[model samples]
Each structure stands twice: as structure tokens, then as C-alpha cells.
Target: MYILKKNEKFNIDNETITFREIRDKLTEEFTELVKAIVNYSYDKTLKNLKAVVREAFDVIQVCILILRKCHTISKDLDYPD
Candidate 1:
């Protein structure tokens, strides 16, 4: 799916993609990919999966930190309370 700008046109096999449509499609695709990865890791030996889980946890931690910082900054700018 492609995002169209003003006066932009494109042909697709199905239908023209909108911003929301693209967003939803991407969300579903990412969700499916994560699910597949997790399932594969689960079916593997613990020794092999440990590193992958640890890396995933680290990524989660970093994402949480970044999100917290973003929230703090957004709140500070929007409402200094």
C-alpha cells in the first residue's frame, strides 16, 4: 500500500490505500511477525532461546525508557504541573 499526497494517484490490484489503512496493515504485519518469532523461540531449546529473550527484554527496556521520556517532555510542554 502506498500513501498518497495531494494530487497523487496510483493504481492497485485491490483498492487505493489510505493513511489509516496503511497504518492498520503495518500494525497487523508487525504483530504477526513478532508472534512468529516468539513462537519459534519458544519451540527451540532454552539455551538457544535465552539470548533471544534477553535481547528482546533489553529492547523492551529501552523502548519503555524512551517512551517515558517522551511522555514527560510532552506533559511538561503541554501542562506544567
Candidate 2:
């Protein structure tokens, strides 16, 4: 990918490559690699998930307070554990 560019000539192996080719070849390569990494196993309890929800809601409440719209709205959001 670093060696190829559109309308650019490479003087190696008596062939030329373009960025479009590099992009096409590497696009799905990166996507597949990311998908492999994204398929991860998370062994966490419902309590842990509830804690995450509560923490995220706490920050959201702070943002709502700053926006001066619905600070209490976040308080009403309950985490079912």
C-alpha cells in the first residue's frame, strides 16, 4: 500500500501498480482482520454489566446537566441486574 500510487510507475519486476489496486486488495483485508479481532469473548457477570450501565449513565447525566435539559432523566434510567 505504501509503494503504490495512482498513475505512478514502479521500476521493479517490470510491472506497474496503482493505488486503486492497492486499495481494492487491502480494503477487505483490513476489514476481515478487524472482524477477526472484533469477534472476542467477554466473560462478565450481570453485575459488571450493570456497573458499566450505571457509570455510562452517570456521565450522561453530567452532560445533560451541562446542556440544562434533563439531568433527572438519567436518574430515572435504572440498570436491571
Candidate 3:
């Protein structure tokens, strides 16, 4: 998203976005995804499908943002997989 494309321009509460903010956002998005999944499991309606898709995308987008922001620290870590 725009944050990944222009992270320098993004701000939250008049402050730069931080890992804590990202973590909080990720947690909230994931919780919404779980709620959507649970609702879909019982309803199985088109509306529920759309909700699930939307929530999933939200979770994925936040994850992508995290990955994009983590590039700076990736060099300091080791990956065997």
C-alpha cells in the first residue's frame, strides 16, 4: 500500500509509525480475520464470504507492510529456510 510505497510520508497520531503501532494494527487485523472466519463458518453466505475476504486482505496487507519495513533489519538476521 501507500505506506510501503511512501513510508516516509505516513504518520500516526502526528508521529512516525513504529513497530509497536504496526504490531498493534497487525493484532487487531488478525482478530478481525478470526471473527470473520468464525462468522463464515456458521453462515456460509455471500456476505460472510466477502467479509472473510476483506479481513484476510487486511491481514495480508499489514503483513506485507511489516515485511517491507523489516528489510532494514533483515540484514542483521539469518534465515535458513
lDDT of 2 by residue, 9-62 (tens): 312221233345434444544554444434422535665566555544444433
Ten residues in sequence with the least summed lDDT for candidate 3? 6-15
- Superposed by TM-score, candidate 1 places the C-alpha of residue 12 at a distance from the truth, in angstroms, of 47
Give the per-residue Cα lDDT of candidate 2 at 4: 22
In order of appearance, the predictions have TM-scores of 0.40, 0.32, 0.71
Report lDDT (CA) for all predictions.
0.46, 0.39, 0.74
Q: In TM-score terms, which candidate is top?
A: 3
Which residue pairs show collisions in model 1? none
The superposed Cα distance between candidate 2 and the true structure at residue 15, in angstroms, equals: 70
**Model 2 accuracy (lDDT, Cα):** 0.39
User: For model 1, how does the per-residue alpha-carbon lDDT over 44-73 read when each residue is reduced to its tens digit?
Assistant: 766546655655554443344344445555
lDDT of 3 at 78: 98
